[model samples]
Target: MEILESKEQKLFARNLICVGIDKCENGDFCGRIWEPYDDQPFKFTGINEMVIHMDDLYDEWNYPQRALNERSFLRTHEMARTNIIRDDGFVEKIDRLQKMRGEIGTFIVQVKFRQHATWQGVVVWAEENKRGNFRSAMELVHLIDHAINKGLLIK
Candidate 1:
């Protein structure tokens, strides 16, 4: 999968919710995609967390390694593609294509899906890209509200 970082906010087709308004150690706020449609909690620091979550998803699917484009899955499997969001309101798309089979090893490879950047501006890109369908979104909101009410979302 390919990753990208940009100040353009229209980069992603889906927008996650701002569950926690708390800032990180760097004074930047974080938004959690509580349910990234897969029941796995996806937390991203700024926008790069999108990459982190996708990478984790890759690991969960391949088990021990990420999907290596034409060298990861078999010829009959479908490619996995998802559009990531950018801080500038743009889209950063990641496409994982055909996986290769029958080669094994235990060396861990580090994947880089982000670029270097410093906080030079403030746009609060989490203004859009609302995720999930109607019912799902409502369920998420209700769940988070319940959690917050029960002191589960905040301490």
Candidate 2:
């Protein structure tokens, strides 16, 4: 995986979405992926579709952890890539290959996939300098749910 410098300009120019793989120090394949949204200048709504490879499934039960270090579980499987959607108007595609490599000896996991697998997570960011006074992550989650049901995340 390549660490693309997430600059302010680049983030603003193109819709920025990130995918990461989590694993133990050992060389064990734990199928897991993460997608995050940081729409600074624009107010993003949600994601489109998250697609992942199917061959990476190891019995479909034993898999990597999908939740991030923050303990936010998307309620998806580990072997199968998951997708999350927001309500605003932004979409991010996630996959195993796009996972970020661990830093120098920092005790991290590696992301690998025999085939191309992808998943989409929808996210909504604040509008450009528009403070709606929206508080609480639950509120944001509700908004995302609404967007998903409305089919607004689709391209």
Using lDDT as the measure, which candidate wins?
1
Model 2 ranges with Cα > 4 A deviation: 1-134, 151-155
The Cα local distance difference test for each model comes to 0.28, 0.24
Q: What is candidate 2's lDDT per residue for 1-155, written digit by digit as tens?
A: 11111122112212222322222234222322232332221111221211222113211322232223222257644343333232334323323212333121011112221121221222221121111111323332333333223433222
Put down candidate 1 lDDT per residue, 1-155, tens digits, no spaces.
11112333321122322234233436333544332233333455653453345444443333223324433455645535443332243222111100111111000112222112111111111222111211222233333233323423221
> Best by TM-score, which number?
1
lDDT of 2 at 12: 22
Query: Which residue runs of candidate 1 sit more than 4 Å off their true CA positions?
Result: 1-27, 36-40, 46-50, 62-155
TM-scores of all predicted structures: 0.23, 0.19
TM-score of 1: 0.23
Q: What is the lDDT of residue 148 in candidate 2?
A: 27
Q: List RMSD in Å for every model shown.
A: 17.5, 18.5
